[model samples]
Target: MSLGDEPGYGDAPRGEDGGYGGTGQTRTRLPDRAGDVYGGARRGRSSSRSLVTVVGVVVLLIAAIAFANRGDDESAPGTGDSDKTKTAPTAASGEQPVQSTAGGIPAGFAHTGQGAQSAAANYAVALGSAEMFNKSKRDAILTAVIIPSRVAEFESSLDKAYTPGFNKNVGLNEDGSTPQGYTFVSRTTPIGTKLTSSSADHATVEVWCSGLLGLAGDNSTNPVTNGWFTITMKLEWTSGDWKIVTHSQKDGPTPVPGDDRASSADDMAKAVEEYGGFTYAR
Candidate 1:
C-alpha cells in the first residue's frame, strides 16, 4: 500500500499515469473474455474449440488475472527488423514513445523490436488490469490491443476462463465490481523486456513484471499481495501496429522480499485511490 517508500518501477515513464479505471468509454462488450487478463489464456490457431470443454481451463481465470499488471518505458516504434536473438533490457530507447492512443490505449507502435517490446509491456498492463473483469472495459481493451482477425478467439477463451464464479474468488462481485467496503487492487509493473525474436511482420517479446492483487480493506479476507512473473507474448505487425497474437506466463526471476513494513488496509486503500497507473508502456 505504501509504495511511496518502495522503489518505483524502473521502467515507468516520465509522462503522467492514470488511475484504476478504463477508457471511460465502453464501446462494445465482446462476450468473450478476450485476452485472459494477460494471465495467459491464448488464442491458439484452433478457432472452434470451446474453452469451456476443459473444466477450469484458461488456467484458473482469476488466479491468472491476479498474477500480473504495471509498466511504462519510453521509446518510439520503429520499422527495422531486430538482429537475431536481441534481448532488450529496461533502458530508455531515446526514441519518443508513442504519442497516439487507439480507443484510449497506446497505439502506432513502430514495426521495430523496441516498438514491439513497448506494445507488449503496455498490452500486458491492460490485459492484467482490474478493468478486464468488466465486460465492457475488457471488450474495448481487447479490441484495441488484439489482432483483429483473432479477437473473437481470444475473447472466447477468456469468456470461459473468467467466469462469474472466478470473479467472486478474487474478492470482486460476480459482476467484477468491488464489494461495498473493500478496494480491489490488480496491477502489473514491468521490470524489463527481452526481444526473443523478430522479423518484418512478427515478433515475440517477454515482459518481466511484478504485480499486486487482492482486496485492500480492514477485515478483508483477501488482503492485497504481490507476485513476480514473466509474460511472453507473440506479437504481429497488424493494422499498422503491433498487436498480441498469443501470450503465456511463467513464474519469475523474483528477488528476495524486502523487509519494508507493510502498509495498513486504510493506507493501502487510500494509495489505490490517490495514485494513478500507466497506459502507455514503452
Candidate 2:
C-alpha cells in the first residue's frame, strides 16, 4: 500500500488518490452447482478413455527413460570439474543461524546468502506496515533498514506517495488518523524468502508476502482484505549490517484462493487488535 494512502473498499473515491499502497479489490465467486455435481456412476466410454490415458502415460514414461540413458555412456560422473560439484548451490546448509534485531526489525544476519534472505523478509514487513503512514515511525524504519546515503531520497518519495487525499479515500483523516469508531488495518506477512544473487558486499533477495489493508467499522466502505505480492530488496553490507539499498514489489506468485466466509467488520477490527505481528527470518 502507499505509505499514507488508504485503499477504497466498496466504491472508488473521487480523485486520483483513491488507491492505497497497491491494494486492490478481491472478487468472490460462488460454486456453480450443489453437491454431487459429478454423477457417481461412470459410463463404459469413460472407463475406456481412462484406460487409454493410463497407457499413453506409461508409454511416455518408458520413452523418457530411454532418452535419459542414451548418452550416459559418453559422459561419466566426476568427468567434469570436481570443484564445481563441491560448490554447487544448495537450499540450506544447516549452519548456525544469526538471529538478532535492531528497532524491532531483524538484524545481525550473517554475511551469507541465508542472511540476505532473512534481512529482505524482515524489511518487507517494515516497509508494508501501517506505521509507514506515520512520519516518525516511517523515518525510524527507514533509518534502521536503509543505507545511510539513500534514506533522504527514499523518505521524500514516500512522503509524496502518502498524500492527504489518499488518506481520506481509505477511510482515514487527512493526517492518517482512523475515523471515529473505525479501526484501520494494514499489515504484511512474509511467507518465505529466496536469495536471487549474492556477493561479498551485495545481495538481492525476494520475499513472498500476503497483506491485509483497509478499514473496519460499521458501514465502512472498505473492509480489511488480503492480497498477495512479492517484494525484492537489493542489500549492501555496510557498517557490519546488511542495509537496504533499493527495493521494489510486484503482484504475486499467488495461490488459488480457497472458499471461506468473510467476517464482519467488528470481528475484523477485534482480530487486528488482538493479533500481534511477527519478526520474520529465513
Candidate 3:
C-alpha cells in the first residue's frame, strides 16, 4: 500500500512517459502469464449479475434512451432520407491525426466535430481492451480517457463488476490471471463511427465495433468468438482534449455471419501474439 509502488492495486502502472502504455504497441512474445496487463483474453458475454458489467445501469440507460431518440433503425444511428444518412467513406479523412498519446491511448484530439468522433472511436478501443480485466491497468485507462471528475465512480463500479466470479466465468483464474497453457484474447476493433449529436462542447458518438473475447486453447470451453456491438459515448471537450462523460454498449446491427473456416486454438493463439491492434482513426 505505498505510492509509486508495484504490486499495489492503487498504483497506475507507468510507461516511459510515466503514463499507462499505449495500445499502439504490438505483442511480440508471450508473457510468463497470459493474464498480465496489456493484451489478450475473452470471457464469453454473459448476463448473470456477476458477469454483467462495464457501464451496467448506465449502459442500459444509454442504450435505451439514445437509440430510442435515434429510432430503431438497425443499419444507421439515425433515420433520415437515404441520401442524407448514407455511410461515409471509410478511407482516412485527411484530418490531423492525434499527435500525442497518453498511456498508449491516443490523445490531443482536435476540438472539432471530427475530433470528437475520433476520440469516441479510439476511446472505445481502449475501454474494450484486454487490459481492462486487470485492475491496475483498468484504472490507468479510466484515468486516461474518462473525464477527471468521474474517474472514481467508474473505477468503483467496474471494480465491483470485475469480481472473482466474473473472472472465473471468463475462463481466467480467480485472481484474474490467464490460466497457464492458454491464451486469453479480448480485443475491440472499431468498424465505423457515427456522430449522433453534437454541439460546440458536447457530443455523442456511436462506434460500431467488432470484438473478440474468450480463452483460445484446445479443449477450451471458452473458445474465442467474435461479436458485433455498438458503443455510444457521450464526450465533452475539456482541458484541451476530448474525454468521455458517459458511455454504454448494446448488441449490434450484427450482419449475417459468413461461412469461414475457424482457426485452431494454436493458430488463434499465434495470431493474437503476432497481430497488433491499431490506434483507431475517424
Candidate 4:
C-alpha cells in the first residue's frame, strides 16, 4: 500500500486493472478476505473497524436529512417547473442557466435551492471522472466547476498531480490522449444529496455516490475500476449561478457484490468506447 506504487487509478494500464480499495479516506477495519475488497462479513473484527462503519452510516443519514430540508427555505424555493423536474426524474437536476452554455453543455446555473444540489452532484461526477486523469479535460472541468478565486491554485496543484506519464499510465494515449477502440468510463451516481448550509450568496452540499473507473479493451491495462465515495462541496452563488468553492471526499460504507463473470478485455473496451456518458442526478 505504498503511495504512487499502488497499482491502478494513476498507474500503467492492464488488461483488467483489478479493483482496488477506494481512494478517498480509508476506514479503520479488518482487511478484506482474499480477493474481496469490501471485507466480507467475518465475525470477531476489531471495534475500531466497527466504529468506522458506524460513522460512515451516520454521515450518509445526515446527508439524506439535509436533502429533505433544502427547498423549504423561503429565499429561493425555486419555480414549480424546476422543482418538478428535480424530483420527478433524477436526470432533471442540473445547475445550468437558461442562457449560458459551454462546449454545447450547460454552463451557468441559476442561484436556487435545487441548483445547489444539482451543482453538487454534477461537480462530483466531473471531479471523479476519467477526464480528471488528462490535463486538458481536467482544466476544462476545473474551470467549469471551481469558484474563480480558487481556480488557479486548484488547477496548478492538480496539474502537478496529473502528470503526463501518470495520464498515460492510467490508460490515456501518449500526449495525454484518448485512444481509439477504448471507452474511458469514470462516472459517479449520487445516491442522494443534502444541503449542509446555504444563504443567498453561498451553499454547501454533500453527495453520496457509487462510481466506475476503467478502460475497456483486450490488451488494456487499468480495465474499469469501481468504488463508493462521498463528495462535500462548498459553493458560491456567483453571477446568478452556483460555482464550487472548495471540496473534499471520503470513502464508503460499500456493500459486497456477488461473484459474476468478469468480462473479457476486448468486450469491456468495445462497450466503453461505444457507450455514452450521462448527466447523473438523484
Off-target runs (Cα >4 Å) in candidate 3 are: 1-91
Ranking by lDDT: 3, 2, 1, 4
Which scores better on TM-score, 2 or 4? Answer: 2
Segments in model 4 whose C-alpha atoms lie over 4 Å from true places: 1-100, 178-182, 280-282
Candidate 3 residues 118-212, lDDT tens each?
Answer: 99989998998889999999999999999999999999999999999999998988888999999999999999988889999999999999999
Write down the RMSD of candidate 4 (Cα, Å): 14.1
lDDT of 4 by residue, 1-282 (tens): 112222232332323334335434333555456876545443344587679989999999999788657745533555665565656554545444245555433455556766788778767877877778777788888888888888999999997877777777768776666688777777777787888898888888889889887677657777776688888899998766688888888998576553345777777666666876655433
Highest-scoring model, TM-score: 3
Mind sharing the TM-score for model 4?
Answer: 0.61
What are the clashing pairs of model 3? 20-103, 21-103, 22-103, 22-104, 40-184, 41-184, 41-185, 41-186, 42-214
Off by over 4 Å in 2: 1-99
lDDT of each: 0.77, 0.78, 0.82, 0.70
Kindly list the per-residue Cα lDDT of model 2 for residues 1-282, writing each as its tens digit: 212222232333444444433355433333345663323222233476679989999999999788657645555676654433334443334444456777787778788777788778778888888888788899999999999999999999999988899888877889988889999998999887778888999999988899999999999988788999999899999998899999999998887554356788999999999999875656
lDDT of 1: 0.77
TM-score of each: 0.68, 0.67, 0.69, 0.61
lDDT of 4 at 41: 42
Q: In angstroms, how far off is 196's CA in candidate 3?
A: 1.1
